[model samples]
Target: LILMLVMVGLLSLILGMGLPTTANYIVVSSLMAGVVVELGAQSGLIVPLIAVHLFVFYFGIMADVTPPVGLASFAAAAVSGGDAIKTGFVAFFYSLRTVALPFVFIFNTDLLLIDVTWVQGILVFITASIAILVFTAGTMGWFLTKSRVYESVALVLIAFMLFRPDFVMDRIQPPFQQVEPSAFTEALGNAAEGDEIRLVVSGPDFDTGDNKETTLVLSVGAGSGEERLANFGLLLLPEDGVVKMDEPSFGSAFSDSLSSFDFYGDDPVQIASVQAPSNQMAKEWVFIPALIFLAFIAFLQRARISRQGVPA
Candidate 1:
């Protein structure tokens, strides 16, 4: 999956060089994601999927601002007669923020709308925007009083928080806390409600062998006594046909024969739940090494600046 995604991104970037944004998305999504789907990855996660596609898309466009075939820089140089390589470098640096944005959205689903709440959605937009601003400052070495080393470090830290919304950051140093009285308060209030609701298993099917196998379906609900707004069926499977209901008070009760086996094993089941955290975390693990690498670059840049006595 990882290799496939990377290939999609690389293909998109290479194909999208000098293409407009809309054309890039259309071409890549039409070509790249189709190939991925044919290979069996779910299409529902297409947003992040396309985000990955766009990561390479933007980088491909950025090649126009880089050397050798730097079309945009070449055009600008033709008008000004400045050094083409220097012009390309300047253009690339000036446009670096645009190049970095698609990667952020690809890694952070809040930006791409995966399991995002209203408040969380808002925080993501605000923080991401601010992160872009900070990135601009860091790249240009201009912010409140021409950002110094510590200030650059602070900007990078803030950008990290903004780029990735993790539970650890929420608990310790929430940037959204200072937004407004209602923002954080409402988010906490919703958090108290807990977005995920657990549904208890009930009834039995004749497919089990000894009836010792128990089946339970976990679902989201309004509250303890309220009817479930959505149905996310069975969490487990029973080897036997008999099972007792433990928590009938949770959601609607149903008893039916197990569906035919198809996708997984001899018995097939349809899953309607949101993407699991384990899966998400695993996917996100790909970005950790990349993040560490970027952080190292920042650290090296800071050290170099310090040595030169330049305001970082």
Candidate 2:
């Protein structure tokens, strides 16, 4: 599957090289995107649909600036009297500035605008765009003012922090605090009506027999027992001191969550583990320092530009 991902990405890149924009998108996405989606899940990657499509599309578009047969570079060379190969290399270098974005969205679906609240969407857009600009400034060695080498490096690091502040905090403090399965009964019993119960479970895949892990976010009801579980679309019947999955309501959250894991007829899946969501430090927390650094650079650059009598 890892091989498949690499192959898909490379193939998409190659196919994108000479193809026109719309056709390039249609061809690569139609051919390779599905392979990534299917093989990725089987490989335990579970990348978002939006991310995969964008990933292929990005590489396809990148082909235009790539070496050897780069049409964009040829056009630029024709206009600027430069070698086409050199122009292609230069264009490719510029394109590298935005390459990290696809990988970012692949790991963090928030950047793809998936499952984000309206407020979060706005914040993400603002912070991400600003971070990209900062990164560009660092790479180009210019901002509002010309940047020293060390200052450019610092700006780049600051940009990365603003782009994915949670990355560092996660290493320092893991986001999830494990919950014991033994305490599940108490937790479920005590949960108020309409509350969400998040459970992470791992079991053998019913189809492939491979062990796979998935999270089940079940909703609690106003009542308790089988009735409570039923509210979340689960029907469990006990037979001879053993709990069994009786019937999962079609189109219900229970069935939807359960579909990700393997379940056999009338057999209870052992709960290998559990986790209650823990709030992590907000990514925006790092944005403050990043913005301050950006402002400092801007101030220095503005002063330099003024000294040169450049137009404001």
Please tell me which predicted candidate would have the highest TM-score against the true structure.
Answer: 2
Writing each residue's lDDT as its tens digit, candidate 1 over 240-261 gives 4322122222343432313312
Which 10 residues in a row give candidate 2 its minimum summed lDDT?
238-247
Task: Please give, for residues 4-30, the per-residue lDDT of candidate 2 as tens digits.
Answer: 755776788799988889999999999
Which candidate comes out best when scored by lDDT?
Answer: 2
Which stretches in model 2 have alpha-carbon errors above 4 Å? Answer: 1-8, 31-47, 74-82, 115-119, 144-146, 169-173, 182-201, 205-210, 214-270, 296-312
lDDT of 2: 0.73
TM-score of every model versus the real structure: 0.48, 0.69
Q: What's the lDDT for all of these models?
A: 0.49, 0.73
Instruction: For residue 248, give model 2's deviation from the true position in Å.
Output: 6.2
